[model samples]
Target: MGYVKTTFLMAAMTALFMGLGYLMGGAGGAVIALVMAGAMNLFTWWNSDKMVLKMHNAQALAAGDRFGLVDMVAQLARNAQLPMPAVYIIDTPQPNAFATGRNPQNAAVAVTTGLMRSLTREELAGVVAHELAHIKNHDTAIMTVTATFAGAISMLANFALFFGGSRERLGLIGTLAMMILAPMAAALVQMAISRTREYAADKAGAQICGHPMWLASALQKIQHGAAQIDNDAAERHPATAHMFIINPLHAHSRDKLFSTHPATANRIAALQALAGTMQPNAPRMRQTDMGPSTTSVPKVRKGGKRGPWV
Candidate 1:
């Protein structure tokens, strides 16, 4: 159902873009807009992950890093039956994380230093699993496309506004309305698609981690921490705000129509409901009877040492 909704919304966004183009320059303009949107999406599909990581200055973690963060991701990846993804640590105090890649094979997971220091071992696992779920479900790719289209639509609106597009075809009043409402409509559609994927990712993350309560607990902490700490990187790149496990931007409107992620309280309630259905001792993975062994697990550093947040 989520995918279906996302598909419909994406189509609507495209139609909106083409319509704006027609309003601006007739059939020729519509064709040009469609080509530009397609080209931009293709470019974003190939390079968005790299661009996002670089924007946040994420540093890749080595497999043998003493912090054992990569090791933890390794274990979770095994449980999720996903190929090991490149892990990165962001140099920020905000407790947050996100996943990005075109597909599972090329995926990457990044967490802020604040997240590591703030969350417990179990809570961290839950967070990582949630990001991995995004990779497994290919949400990153879908979101990139959505963003690309949204951006293109906004640009088209701006172009029309500045140039007084097709003034003869669309009266001055009609052009003014397009300039004001077109970008707002694009934003609404983009936010709706983002909200839908977030719920699906939450459900799949809980299943992958085998502990709905773990994520529920993590979300609570991250939400509180994010509210207190300002992420400069997120502030500068508001468009990428939707990629995070929690909304990293501050001063968000309470209206759901404008919010990116689902409300944290509502998300926690859903997880708590999911927890009610699982057995108390149910194993995390259903594919294998045997549980993950701790023999190879590395000792995570204890004490409040402020190491890099990976």
Candidate 2:
């Protein structure tokens, strides 16, 4: 997402928060909610990275690890003209990755161990580049903040249940509907933004890596793995779903209004379009599109950089 879009999302989320407050306690509640929203925005700007990393149980990746993962990220960061971002490993079995921070200077890229086990070195670089694109675009700050807003909105919606009909201007029935609908509305906006940004990231990442097909190939593998394996952390904290390259909670092969990420096929198609120009006569990405149940990445190799880095 761009600065303009991020600003819009921030406004929309605060509005949702305030609207819920008004429903529960009238104008006075709206004032309080506005104050809370301002505080929350500032809080997320400073701390959302730490909160998200903690939420997923992400651990700092050992520097100069045997995987060469850290080194690869460093190289890519240089390629993207970005400062080195913190690298983290999430121990989930699902193959997915995300970037988080308030800005490019403080960003972090997190990948699952399952991702290390599933994607080739080139594919992993593609994923990292994609995340860097998000960091470079300042999408992480908004995304992390959005997750916090989404979660808080859900909580506030639930809190409305405790208020009697007379207390809420909406009354009991209206309160119940808002309780159900408010968070859903927030999620819809979250997903919509995610879908839009994923495409932009894919393009920028391809340019950063200088190989569109690499990311296209990785997306196919990740989509397949994500669909079959469970990401327990993501399921527990569903609000963070939009941060991932692929929605860790569920797999969607087609686009929909509420889907957290774009359809895998559509993303691949977009990347493939880039590949056509950058890599003339390159064979279409195929055969590697099957699920992880049927296929796994090649083992770490000693000589060249074709296999899994880990």
Candidate 3:
């Protein structure tokens, strides 16, 4: 049922894009706009991982340098039956993560320094597993296409207002109406489609983690941390907000109506309900099956305080 609704929403978004193009100039302009959108989609599909990583100034981590995190991601990928994606760490204090690539084989997962500092190892695994789920379910590709086309629609609407529109097409009233409503409609379509995809991804991510409570806990932390932090990159590039694990922008406070992510509370509630069905005593799988570690733990600094890694 969710899949069906998502398919319909995607179709609607495409239709809206094409219609906006038609309004901008007629058949020729619509064709040109769609062709450009297609070309951009293809480009973004192949290069979006690099683009996003650069946007956040994220640095790829070597397995030897961050062996623990690398090993955990590798183990999760093995369980998910996926190729291990390139991993990166962003310096931001926001506890968020996102996955990008055209497909599972080419994917990359990037998490913030804050996420590593804030989450327990188990909770961090849940977050990585959720991103792996995005790669597995192909949400990254779908979202890249949606973002590409939605931006094209907005571009076409702006073009119509400035260049393509003619005074004689209709009266002044018609021109005014098109200018006012076209961009709003395109934005509505983008938000509606993005929200649905987020829900589907959340469900798939919970399944991948196999313990919904981990994700519930992670979400609780992310929602609170994200609200306070400024993700400057996401702010500069608002079009990519839907690609994030959490909406990385702060501009939604005024309207709340335009947010691409579903309500955090609602998402947490669903995850909690899923957690209720799992056995409370289920043992968590380890990165290595040999046994628990007996080595001395490394020290970690938090809030200017020192502690042993737990």
Candidate 4:
């Protein structure tokens, strides 16, 4: 159902893009705009991971780094039956993570310094598993295409506004309508697709990690931490906000219409419901299973001082 909805939304975005093109230059313009959109999507599909990582100032994690995060990610990838994705760390205080790539084999997972400092070992595993789920399910590819079409639509609208639209086709009233509503329509379609993929990723991630509660707990902490600490990179590049596990932008009301991620509370509730069906002991992580001499899980406190994990 989620995939079907995403497919429909993506098609709507494409149609909206072509409509704006037609409004700008009739049928010829629509065809040109579609070709442009296709070319742009192809470029993004091949290079988006590198572009996103560079945008965030992500640095590669070398094997010699003693933090054990790379090792943990390796284990999770094996569990998901995916090729090991390149690992990176962003030097930010915001507790967030995202995955990018055209497919599982070429994927990269980047987490913030704040994320490593904030989440417990199990919670971190859950987060990594969630990202792996995105790679496995090819949500990255879906989102990249959506963004490409949305961007192209907005570009067409901007061009129409500046260069006097196709008066022969749309007239004054139609041109005015396209100028105001086209970008908004694109945004709506993009947001709908993002929210749906987030839900699917959460469900699949819970299964990959073998523990819904772990991700639920991490989401709670991440939501709280993200609200308290601003993610400068995410703020600067708002279009990339949907890529993160949590919405890294400033807090918004629970209105699903304007938000990139589903409400954290709503997502947590869904994960809690999933947790109810699993065996009670199934989600517990053995400390020894983590590499040697790893720190114990941090006890997160609400509205209190930062813990030792940070």
| Best lDDT among the predictions, by candidate number | 1
Tens-digit lDDT string for candidate 3 (25-102):
677766877788889899998998888889889889777543376777777787778999999888877778999999
Please report the TM-score between candidate 4 and the true structure. 0.91
Top TM-score model? 4
List candidate 3 segments past 4 Å from native.
163-167, 251-255, 278-284, 287-310
Model 4 agreement with the true structure over 256-285: per-residue lDDT tens digits: 687888888998899999888876644344
Q: Is candidate 1 or candidate 4 better by lDDT?
A: 1
Q: Name the regions of candidate 1 deviating beyond 4 angstroms.
A: 162-165, 251-255, 279-304, 307-310
lDDT of 4 at 108: 97
**Candidate 2 lDDT by residue in tens digits, 3-32:** 567578778888998888887777877887
Number of colliding residue pairs in each model: 1, 0, 0, 0
List the candidate 2 regions with Cα displacement exceeding 4 Å.
Answer: 1-9, 163-168, 278-296, 299-307
Which regions of candidate 4 are displaced past 4 Å? 162-165, 279-286, 292-310
Q: Clash number for model 3?
A: 0
Per-model TM against the reference = 0.90, 0.85, 0.86, 0.91
Global lDDT for candidate 2?
A: 0.81
In the range 87-177, model 1's lDDT, one tens digit per residue, is: 9999898999999988899899999988887776777788988999999989999888988888888888878855545566777777778
